[model samples]
Target: MSKRCFLIEASNQEATEGQIMTVVQSSASHPLYGDIVTIVGKNRVNDNPVIISAYSKDSCHLEAERPGIVVMPNSVEEVQKIVRLCSSTKTPIMPAGGRNGICGACLPRVTNAVMLDMINMNGIVNLDEDVMTITVEAGMRWAELIHRLDDKGYKLGFRGPYGGNAATVAGSVSINSMGYAASRFGPAPEGVVSLEVVLPNGEIVRTGSGWNPEAQIFTRYSSFADLTGIFLGDHGTLGVKTKVTFKIYPKAEFSTYIDLGYKNLKDATAAFLEIQKRGLTEELNCLLARESADTYFPGLLDSHPEINATIHCVIMETDKQLAERKVQIIRDIGLDLKGKDLGNFAAQIHWAEKFNEVQPMYNNGFWLNTCHLRPISRIPELMDRMRAIFKKYSLEKNGIKWIADALAVDRAYAAAWVTIFAPTKDKMELAEKAWNEMLDAAMETGGCPYWSGLLWEKRALEKVNDTFIQLYRTIKKSIDP
Candidate 1:
């Protein structure tokens, strides 16, 4: 197998071997330093077999400025100690919680700095079902938490697909992740009731009702002007999260999957918006794209090939006896537009397969998958512009192929996922250009990109409304400065 190279540019310049070793020894001698092993042996962060020639004796660049490191922090005191040292030395620190961040948020900056990995701190501290809160160490796996909660007949609202198994509760909140159930419960940040953050100055700050009166929201009851919100999505730039307490919800009473196929992306999004606008179900998860429908349901795949040009599937659940009635409403919406319903049996079976099937989608194929986020209401416009762009890319001989899907956030909000496949590298570039145009068009229609925090490029970010960016900047300066 050939190894692919990832392009990286460091905001901070790389340090020399002598300087790197000096920094390493400084931390190694610090009181908080538990295990200071050099980045030696074989590198496993990116899983690529390529040899890195420009690396220092212990460290190597994996992606962009992200240098991977493994650290063993034995205690909270140790974490605080390291933070103090990093702050005093002016070294950037990146935290790794379970090493499952797809966007390289945990990857170290290009400078000769320490990467604090919180894998060893996986402990469930307290489970207070009375108030419906679970307090666990920052490194605890979400799946373990879900398993424990399931034993008690409850679970967290957003467990994030299969990635939850390798994900940490603190990491999810830090990244502001909104998994499958994001529409109803909101993102991970909203679920967090309190946070335990180790500041760069070696001080531990505990936020929320843990420190002060519940009614008093004006006071800086926690630490440094109430910086929990700042630290949540800082991408580990500000500080390290040691412990977290968040809300949980009961499992659904009943769940059903309904499949709807459309002749094109426009019709598919129309059906999705219809269900979202009409409140067709309490909990909804939908997958749209004719390709997915064809792959998941081959029987209908051939009979309704044109119907799949835009494929749609919905997952809805309710406790009431009128469950079928609600599903019928969704079915009716689909049927009204000449859409075909593959019924719930296929949807149920797909959900059962879950992430086991999703992970493989990114591997073992000559195709590429990229997505864009937009406000739910503007999905139709986005689709129209995207199809034109796809057509433009398809003029080449490689024969560009693609599929689009949309997930409804609410009546007025939604995110669309577009998958593109092309045979030539130039065609892929053209396809990427289309994706960017789609992203720009989405922003013009009041749609915010779903995960734009760690991409490093600020082009799409600059398109977001200035007010939110100002708020983000203020928070970053306060907590991370």
Candidate 2:
């Protein structure tokens, strides 16, 4: 096969040497390329093969049908115009953010779709300290938003996902991402004050307090039916989120990190649930099994091979005394559960290198991630079932690796991130089979995934109540169709 090399742009930023991928062909002209260029200027649009392949898949192992063209819209007006044009031409349009999603959420389902690269639209629209709210263009990255807020002595309740370096505010919000301070503030949508969305029919709609033209965009529960929720976690099926208003908080003055080691998963899970219930941490994550701990921390457990699981907690407060009190309470709960103080290395490293840490794990193998939410008390049952599945598939014997981990979210549930590593291309098929089985097992155990995208969409839909699915479809069709 004839091969061509192209430097893939990193989230609409500069191309890096590591991003150079070998694909076929060069730029191919599209029928609507001229129209798109006219809307967003020629420089912001591309019919190039490199851009096509770059947008063909997210961080998932699967690729979608290649898009015919990619358009970068820098403003709400430009997005509206492009959507109007696509609607009039009956062309499928897919709005994409940083493309950092692990699932196939941003990929176009059809070959002739127009991929909207929203990166160019990144800009902070407003920062209102009076109301403790920040209004920003949907394309703004979480890391940028956090730093900007930090400089202003404010922070978001739920900061962002672990991939905040490349994950966009709107992208994470749209998928209902749970990370950072999720243990305290719930998911990203919980912090949303309002949203400005461009509907499928090329009409603009503002939700929450923005529903009233005269009201300030300060609350999500106000005005009529709380329509802002219609778009949250919709995975871009309803509309394109152009602007988002988030509730911000004053930056905490004190913070602490703690790590606890347990001899078994049950004790670790018990301590994790207690910490979350007592609201002692801003962030809480636990490795449910020895393999998972080894996967994340490597030889850290070498000296303590008896420890089968570990918990990391991050506490932040405006008062030093309060923070210290919370830290002590967390330690007490862990100790009561027969846990050992493992120091703060894991928690500190996780906090300091949030975005950079996850990528290095790819060096182990490609991930078949079955990430979802479940009750914290069920971690032991789920872990046992997962082990059974791994044994059934002879995963370890075949040289494949897996991790069973959970992150505390809200008050009662944990986001279970069960992952299988396909060490090589030859193991991918087997890994996929095992992954599907695991997903089924998770669903049977009352696990609910936040992001569907292409990864969990089919499986999730299958498990969803028919009435709920119909209601969602009804709303989706009423707005889009």
Candidate 3:
């Protein structure tokens, strides 16, 4: 990959490197810098790949202003202490976990910021089967958690996103990711029972039912006011997640797959909504455009009859018969709409290798994805607008491909459109134009785009209720001030 840097701020020009390093040297001057916490100046911090990797080194592909100082803290106490030091110095803090997110929200927007590297704080705090919840430190990985739960005869309510193994629990919850298990259990935030949040001022507060003295981490929406929702998708703006508790479920007795092809995008989305309305599928993981199918699953794409779209369904139930019945319903719906049964053979094969399937859809390289979530009734409208944007920009011929997921028929399902292309100057410009138009249409039509904090928050909120932006700004200031 070509290495290019876009300095996000002028703080570097205003303050010299020596002046920046002074912040760290000054922090170690405090007596609170204990054995569990280590402070590194710009020289040492920039040299360490692990810390830098968490900043802008992974999949997000955006350049972050290099922090003047980096702090490594292994425990919550150390985390609080580090936060206080940054607070006292009035340095902006950006928190990170696993370093695998493609969304640029975690990157620092300004220079001289301090990064809260939470990797070392990973530890399973408790597993209360009696309460039917498990508590883990914020830095724990989803891949490990899944295996751990299964080892003890339990399962999570949701699957991590395709990159779940590389994404942290706190990270995914912060984004409220809609993943493979969304149709079955709900969004990532739905499974979160409580949060142990380190406030901007370094105070640790517990939310959920645990807010009271009972200490049982099972339920959300305690008798008191629920503050947990405030942080569910905040992207770590309000505070740092120290610990979290999530609801769990029994392992499904049966899991099955089915694939269907549609002649048009509109019909595929309609079929998906109907399937979702009937609650027949546990997961509608893939809604691939023709180009998407070609790029991601060439073999399957070759077998299909030049269909414009394809949908992948994952059905699960305790009884094998019931699972098969739901899949049949999906097939019937698809066929009724003049759809083709591509057969479950390809879907089954995809499921077998789904754990490591992130790269196939990534366009073999760089791409931008627009995640739009709205009710099923509006998907066709959104599709028309999205297609127009692509046509206007001639994105179809430029290697751009669109993909959507049936987030839920019962809720606002997501319709994600991705454009894959090499980073050539002309293609990059066109890609930008297409992305902006797609997102604008999404919010204009009562849909919310993904990565709200960074990409679509202002526009989406303004379209819904203009006052919300101000209210959120006020809340942000109130919490961080």
Candidate 4:
């Protein structure tokens, strides 16, 4: 089959004057191109420059090795066939979904890799109301899944990531994303009950209760070892998840949004931890600095000059009284911590535009996001250190902005997105230097990143325990090697 090959001249960081780049090659030249096209059809496979360039980078600032070809498989059988062919040919295969990851997790690490664009495989497989579970194809976007469940008066524990509008169910769970309702439901992986993964050898395996031929996907910790955990947050290293089953909950009828302002980070973080420990929020997030609050809410802090930090709480319950009671308890905690009631404008706006709030902020600058997990109690210390680093980098003088925002996860920890903004291309180098320093500071403060893409892999390897690294390497080699 013949396909259009466009040759373009572009300037890159490594480009010299008058350099030509060949991003795409004719399918006739690729040895495995015909084989992949045969499995998924020509319409579903492309080696065109336009398609390859689009998949070269994700939401992150870094771009890695681009795949030689991209293919969209519509069925599990097609995925298996493609994987088998790649495995036999000793070719690298990378699974990509949604392409909404802030880390470079979806980018191919090798040039010869086959990019399995899983978006086409997106489909709802089952919704077992009796079992209170929803099974969907791995490529299904979270926003669509949530909307479908909403129509049925049901919802997921952790609804989805902040990028839910474009983030896929498997994509968020694969990276253990914490967002939306994570204050009570924890990260995305906690809600997953089962997974249908295609291993590197092209063999299909079912995890959780699905292992039992007679049982449905009801629970994650059933039968032998918790195999489901192996692939959760594996960054698609262990296998390609083709299907996902998530535990569903009846839609909560009542919800209350509250925003509390504290004079200092210590008070704000204390109140946040108290509310989380009491399990009083469906969604909870905090801006631990006045700068962060200003960045997020703009001029709201002008009225409350005494407030240096702000906490936004979203409480949901089956009963209105229960939700109110939880809100009252949170209010009392905030009051005791010397927090001022800021009303629910911030919280309401955030909830109303959950999937959109963060994206639009990109207009402000290029974000060097240092997203990681850290203890709630240590947030004050972390902020102090972060401020020091920012000051050292003269970020404000350089016209670079920053925000330290945290989402309360589970009950005790927080998923912090310490973002550094580079408003112009000229400031990227300084922003990167500040970002790397902040990353080291976060690690020193006992923070752990959920996803180690091209951004955090090197730092994580350097800081991770030797024994843990060996064990992980052994597991990876055994599974994919």
Which one is best on lDDT? 4
Report model 4's TM-score to 2 decimal places. 0.93
Candidate 1 clashing pairs, residues 3+ apart or interchain:
8-64, 289-311, 290-308, 290-311, 375-447, 376-414
The count of backbone overlaps in candidate 4 is 0
2 or 3, greater by TM-score: 2
Runs in model 2 lying further than 4 Å from the true structure: 1-28
Ranking by lDDT: 4, 2, 3, 1
- Over the stretch 1-481, how does candidate 2's per-residue lDDT look in tens digits? 1122111122223222212212443354787877776775556677777778777888878787888888777678878999999888989888888998998888888878988877766777777766778888888999998988799789899989878889998899899898888899999899998999999888999998887776667688863887998899888888999989999899998989899999989889888998899877888999988888887887878888799999999999999999888888899889988999988888888878877877787887998988899999998888888999999999999888888778899898988988888999999998889988998988888888889888888888777798998999899889877
**Cα deviation in Å at residue 258, candidate 2?**
1.5
| Model 4: per-residue Cα lDDT over 201-273, one tens digit each | 9999999998888776778886599999999999998889999999999999898989999988998898899
Better structure of 3 and 4 per lDDT? 4
TM-score of 3: 0.84
Per-residue alpha-carbon lDDT of candidate 3 for residues 191-275, written as tens digits (9 for 90 to 100): 8999999998999989998777645776888688778999988988999998888997777778778888988877887777777
- Superposing every Cα of model 1 onto the true structure, what RMSD results? 10.0
TM-scores for candidates 1 onward, in order = 0.75, 0.93, 0.84, 0.93
Candidates sorted by TM-score, best first: 4, 2, 3, 1
In model 3, the clashing pairs are: none
Model 1 per-residue lDDT tens digits across residues 136-196: 7888777787777778677776655336767788778787665555555556676777778
